[model samples]
Target: MSRKLLLKAVEQAYSDRRRLVAPLLGFPGINLTNSSIKVAQQNYIEHYKVLNALYNEFHPDAMFTLMDLSVEANALGCYTLFPQEESATVLHSSFDESRLEFMNSIEIEGDSRALSYCATVKKMSENFQDSMTCAYITGPYTLAGLILGANKAAEMTLTNPELLDDVCGTAYEKIKTYAEMLTSSGAKAVCVLEPSAVMLGPEQFIRFSAEYVKRITEIYSESDIAFIYHICGNSMHLLEAMCDAGVNALSLDSPETGMDIKKACKSAGDNIIVIGNINPAGKILYGTDDEVFNETEKLLNETAEFPNFVLSTGCDLPQAVPLENIRAFMDAGRKYKLP
Candidate 1:
C-alpha cells in the first residue's frame, strides 16, 4: 500500500470529525504468555495475528509494528534482559565507552531481531495496506541513557557535554538507518519514543534531546512516511520545543505531564497530529470500565475542535489491562457526540 492512501484516509477523517482511534498497542498480553520476550517478539506471525484480532474487534484506523524499544539498543550492543511476558529492557551496555564507539559497527539489518522486526513490518504493510501501519523506534536520548547508564548519562550531560553529544549523535545515525529499513519494508509512519528526555530541564532538553529529534524527523520531512514524536513523562514544558523539532505529530501523556491536549493542539497547530496522554496504567489498567469510558469521552470532548486529534493511550497499554477496559475506551470514542 502506498503511504499516500493512509494519509488521505487520516486527512478525510480529520475534516469529517471521524477521529482516528489507535491505541499504542504493539503486543497485547492476551495473545502472549509469560515466555521469553525474544520468543514473543521474534514471532512476527503471532504479533500480527494478535494485532489483527484486536483490529477486527476494535477496527482501529492505525496499527503498528512491535513496540519494544529495546530492539535497536540490543542490536547496538546493549545487553538486554527479555522477560517472560514482559517488554525487553536494557540490562547494561555491551560496550564500555560512554561515546558508544561501537555504534558505527552495529549492523541492524544483519541483526536477527532487527530482521524479524522489519519482516513483521513488511507483512503488516501487506496485510493492513489500507490503514496506517506505523514503525516504532527508541529516541537518541533514551537509547544513550540505556548505553551510558541513566545516571551517568545525566551527569555527562552537564559535566561532559561533548561525550554525550557524540554518543547521541552516533545513536541517531543508527536509528535513522533502522527507520529507513522499516519504511522500506512497509511502515507507513514512524513513532520515535524519547522518554529519557523528560529528565532534562529545558536547557538540557534543547541541547541533548530536541536537536537530535529534529535531525531524525528531518530524514522523513520530504517522504510520504509520517513521523510522530513521543516523549514519555510530563513534557508539558517541552511541548513547544517538541513542535519545533519538525515532526508531523506530537504525542504526550496527559496524566503524567498534567498537560491539556488543547494547549498542545494550540502549540502544535492544525498541521500536527496530536496523539494521546491517557493514563494507561492508572486509568486503563486499574480503573473501572465506566472510568475508562468517561476519560476517553472527556478527552474527545476537550480536543474535539482540533481536526488532527487522534485518541490513544498516553503510553503503551500494559499487558495486564483488561480487554473490557480497552473496549470501553473505544466505545467511548465511537459513542462521543460532537459538541
Candidate 2:
C-alpha cells in the first residue's frame, strides 16, 4: 500500500467531519495464567497469532502493536517483573550517571523482548499494510522513569535537571530506533505512551517530558508516517504542550483528565486531533453495556464538529476488558449519525 494512503485518510477524515474509531486495542489476552518474557519469546508466533485474531475479530478502524511498553525498558537493561496475567512492569531501574555516560552505546540486541515487539509489529504491518498500522513505545520520560525509578527521575527534574534531560535524551535515541524499526516493518505512525508526564506540572513537563517527546516526533515530521502522543491521567493542562510537540494527534484520558474534548480542541484551535477519554477500565471493561454505549454516544455527540477527533480509549484497552463491551463501544460509534 502507498504510504500516503494513511496520511490521506486522516486528512480526509478531518476535512469531512467524519469521526474515525481507532481505540487502543493492543492486548494479547486477559486470561494468560503465565506470561514471562521467556514464554512470550518462545511462543512469539502464538502471541502474534492471538493479536491478529483479535484485530480480525474486531476490525477496528486502525490497529496497533501489542501491549508491551516494558520491552524497550527491558532492552535498556531494566529488569521487568512479568505477571502471570498482566503487562510487565519495570521492576528495577538500571540507570545512574555512569549508565547515562554510555547510553549512546546501548543497543537492543540479543534475547530481548524488544526484538519480539518489532517482529510482531512487522508481521502486523505485512498483514494489514493497506490499513493504518501503528507501533507503540514508551515515551522518553516514561522510559526514563522506568529505568531511573519514578521518584528519583521526578526529583532529577527538579534538582538534577541536566542529568534527567541527558538520560531522557538517551531514551529518545532508543525510542527513535524502535520507531524506525516499526516504520520499516509497515507502521504508518507511532504512539508514544508517556503516562509519567502526568506526574509533573505543565512547566516541568515541558522541560522534562514534552521536549524529548518532540524530538522523537520531529524525526518523522517530514515523513509519510505520523506520530500520536498519549499521556495517561488528566492531561487537560498539558494539551497545549502536547500540541506544541507537533504530534499529528493527541490522545487523552477524558474521564481521568476531565478534559472536555471539544472544549479543549476549541481552545487549542483546529490543529489538535484529539483521540480519547473513554473510561477503558470504568465503562468498557467493567460497566454495563448501556453505560458503554451512553459514554460512546456522548463523546461522539460532543466531538461531532471536530473531524480531527477520533474516538478511542484514554489508553490501551486492558486485557481483561469484556469483548462484548468492546463490541458495544464499536457499535455505538458505527450507529451514530452526524445530524
Best-matching candidate per TM-score: 1
Write candidate 2's Cα lDDT for 11-109 as tens digits: 676565555778888563433323433455335565667666667767777888666768787777778777655667778555557876666677764
Candidate 1, pairs of clashing residues: 253-277, 254-277
Off by over 4 Å in 2: 1-7, 14-17, 28-43, 93-95, 109-111
Q: Which pairs in model 2 have colliding backbones?
A: 234-257, 254-277
What TM-score does structure 2 among the candidates reach? 0.90
Clashes of 2: 2
RMSD of each: 2.5, 2.9
C-alpha lDDT score of every prediction, in listed order: 0.78, 0.75
**Which parts of model 1 are misplaced by more than 4 Å?**
1-7, 32-38, 93-95
